[model samples]
Target: MKHIKFSISLLLLLVFASCEKELDLQPQQSIGIDAATATPENINGILLAAYDIGRNTSPDNLAPLYNGNYSGYLNISSELLGNTDQVSWNGTFDYLRDIFNKALINNNTGALNIYSDSYAIMGHVNTVLANLDKFDDAAERDRVEGEAKFLRGIVYFDMVRFFGQQYNPAGNNSQLGVPIILTPPDVSIRIERNTVEEVYTQVISDLTDAFAKLPDDNGARADKYAAQAILARVYLQQGNYTGARDAADNILQNSGHSLTATFAEAFDTDDNPSETIYSWVITQQEGTNISNTHYATEALGGRGGDIAITQAYLDKFDSDADQRRNFTYPGEGVSTGLLLTSKHVRQFANATPVRIAEMHLIRAECNFRLNSSVGLAPLDEINALRARSSAPALGALTLDLILNERELELAFEGFTLHDYKRTQRNIGTLSWDDNKLVFPIPQSARDRNPLLEQNPGYN
Candidate 1:
């Protein structure tokens, strides 16, 4: 695929690891200046940066995007290269750092604004919560406070995942993750990484409060159901099976969300379908280099192809019944077998987070992991998805199959690598080597923080 040139389009191509965290260029000025005194409109403008970063973190450009897409392509190749789908310089990881690195080097304080942006909103929440008297009406204060909390929760949640380990209840405190920057950290705060569990605990706490603060549904923004779904994902990663199962079940039962009948329509971009629980809006940029749908086409376009799905990933849904097969079409001039990702095909529209279907799948996995005796729940969930593929449901469900299916079903949505980490699946391996399982903690992080430690086996 042709490499898309970095231009003004690329400047607006803000990349986020998730809705929760971001990489900010060092600020020219401290975030400590009291933004609390700003008018509500200015505060809202500050908050928009968080949302902007969240929207730009397209699944196509995330690290796993390269991993899943290119690896999937290589798996189909008969050559079986030792270098299959690996992100060795010419991959998703490289593109991901482009925006942040540029911003860092140029000292673009605009990027640094995300830190203050998030807390500035949080400050609004605090202001409202602490001084309901300022708002004249209790309902207005409560609603505004809830919106602030939801934004805060989403931002923190994203950061924790990118900068820290997956939440492992058994060893949470021992896990070094992102430093908790709840309030704008003071210049002398000298941040330290918190335990993964602590980060997750705070996320859960923030979301839990958000659920109470939010209504049942909030149109395009996050609502009670979105918070619940996020909480369920956090629980699953933490090995809190019951919590995951319950949170998921609550959404399925109470939130009026449901899966679209066919897999093809599920991800269509022309209109925002009902299944998206929460998402950030993206304005279509014609020349933007990072369109996820263009993944398959980009490489063949001649600029430069960073990653394309391997044949193995395509083969996962080779069954005639799988409707997802039709959704994936070959990019122009591409070889026959490589399938381009069809998950986000909009010429331009907002990205949607999974609504009901994802939560249902989470419940099934949680129950399956808990070894539920009913068995029917997992079967039912699998069948629901299988029905979309037009494939028959397989025999008994196992964590392995569910894990594999989740990858197949949600390949480019940015969960693959993290899921691999959380489940402790062997990463960095073509075969069954354990050494490739965890990422080397950026050596730079260790050099900066003496208390930081690397994942086992990396050294």
Candidate 2:
């Protein structure tokens, strides 16, 4: 006979409180913490929380920087297409700043607060890791740790890129990057900053550990390849061409993942295709604006009113053969000659991967940088994709061609601005000032931690 369970645990209260949010989007303090004190189930809940960060937000979800809104802001295609006419501060800039300010700093940190919520998530994961030895099931325990590490590394990767400079492995040690908060920081332990190198080292360490501990096919919850894919990106940013290539090679060899055959089908408006390795499944929530859901739609249609796609990106596509041209939707308005972004025209409710496909492009770019000969293979890779789209194949590959291909292929996928930085290309004569190149360290963060210094060129 099953016994009736009747016990009150503070852990349950803590977990419940941790998940609940106030209107301000911060967590309501938990009343009891005893249940979570040393329990494996509670440990898993914390890991789950970490996975939730970066899933929803205005910048990724509704900024002109990556999605359809490139029309108004010159900063976008400026470096990509060598056009510098449209870079201006609109809602996208304010949205990104507000998001960083609210989630990273505001007291009511929760699922909405990407930064502080991430710290809370890290807390949960670290707690589980500290108590891993106590779990009865080894596989279960190991999986939990792996997920935690994956989430930690992912957040750190984003932090360094958005708040600090891109990882220059050579300069990371002295460069001001985000604080390397491994475990929870107390008043005393709260850090000022780590060199971009130090932060990257920790990112790689966590991802490496995750790679070893994570399962091969665990479905969306952080597996080995996902960690490897992210690590490949980290390596690419650090200009470790060999490291990036090897990491990409490891995935190509060990994982069954492959690029989608056709450009149109690859980025088709349906939900995420087979190519997605990992994605924050954008679940439908009440009050979540469909237009504000994807970067493409928001960038294209939002109040930002950035410049529309120019003839340059359009010219890259073989107009007659490529179906993506339809997605660009020309003649919608006086300013919007290209009415809609083809990659994402549907409602945002459809579940999709936040990181995929473009990674292959990133891998190819890393290879290209390491050895220009390797560029041929990546060019072939993209051409293979173009051929599937029924577009005419190019005669030969060049850096400019590859760069343009990346812009055409990964447009509005959040890499347009950052990629410009990575390639060290100028955004033409009319676009960004020195201030737009790097984000300021933010006055709020500076006030809290006096040790923090603003990024040069921003002040």
Candidate 3:
């Protein structure tokens, strides 16, 4: 149960230094840049540092902000936005209110943190990519490179979804996207935003290359199938159903992964079920539990109910017989009348980033979209997941039915907003094309980098 500690002090020192010639290292903190590339172990440590940053979900850290909370896994209070009757949020935090209201300013702390944190991780990855030649073994070099790129690709994918307009195929994906920092930026260079298409192209290229270079077995780290699984998600987000289905199918058939026997098993604290493709492993000594953000009540070891499930969302589960329904309970503390979920309960539970069940759903939805051309019958795929939950299966599939299934099955895992936007589905009173759907580029970033332009309507 002892956690492995990976230090990034040296890497951060090197990465944040204003000038290359000013890269001075404290004797006890980290190795010099020359010493880092001098050995395979040193370079490998930097790769581990990237993983450490990726795993950070610390509520206090400005960098690598919590994706789940921001993505609507937990409902926080909002003062700027009128109170919603469905879920109670303790909106004392101004930054969270900015997110809830979709009224993000360029200087909002949460927005700035995500933007800064993503690039911080990317900088580390780029450093690893830059020094791949220094790795003594060719295969080791490829493995490291693949893992780093996989991390980079997912980071870019997340950043683009948050900061840019939804990819519109009709418009040729011409909307402004996040600035792509491929190699670490020079101190004097301010990067400009890439078009949405350009960012996607790089994301796909990174993941595709990662899929090729990664080993079949990477344990908790990313592997070949993890790259493919994420690529499926990217394809789905872009409305490329065929590509999504094929990528997902590859994982379902070839990877030795399968759905856990029951719906509850997927979120079990004792072990990571076979369903997980890639996860952020947590231990007693390291990483805070996500439950702290979602569950209310001191009994549940959560803060005063920062987020609660809306009755509207809860009503999506039409069948009380569905085993997944057991995850919910009457809310307490600040969420006294609402409902909360036990999906993330234990302080040491692992956070699943991708799982096989999602792959099947992706395949099913894609097959449905494509009229059942490439993969299994869409009904069968739907039934497979339904069967796990003991929910009755439907004979035919419809877009609404599929989305409802997604809402129930993937609730609180940070998919709702993206799912609604990508499918052009309206959420509550907001239309798909509403300017508020896309966040403004944080003002701090624009102030620091002149080439960075804000998203429309936020100025």
Off by over 4 Å in 3: 1-32, 57-87, 268-270
Model 2 score (lDDT): 0.53
Candidate 1 — what's its lDDT? 0.51
What TM-score does candidate 2 get on C-alpha atoms? 0.74
Model 3 RMSD to the real structure?
4.5
- Give all candidates' CA lDDT scores: 0.51, 0.53, 0.70
Question: Candidate 3: worst 10 consecutive residues by lDDT?
Answer: 17-26
Q: How well does candidate 3 match the true structure in TM-score terms?
A: 0.88
Q: Which lDDT tens digits does candidate 1 get at residues 36-116? A: 324443333333333443333222333321111111121111111112342111234432333212212212222223333
For candidate 3, lDDT tens digit of each residue in 310-384? 666667787889987667777665667757766755556765447788898899899988887465788888988
The pairs that clash in candidate 3 are 77-89, 77-90, 77-91, 106-442, 106-443
TM values, all candidates: 0.71, 0.74, 0.88
Q: Can you write out model 2's per-residue Cα lDDT over 48-129, one digit (the tens) per residue?
A: 5444332332222322111212111222322223333322212234444333232222221111233344455455555557
- Candidate 3 lDDT at 348 equals 63
Better of 1 and 2 by lDDT: 2
Distance from true location, Cα of 370 in model 3, Å: 0.7
**lDDT (0-100) at residue 233 of candidate 2?**
78
Candidate with best lDDT: 3
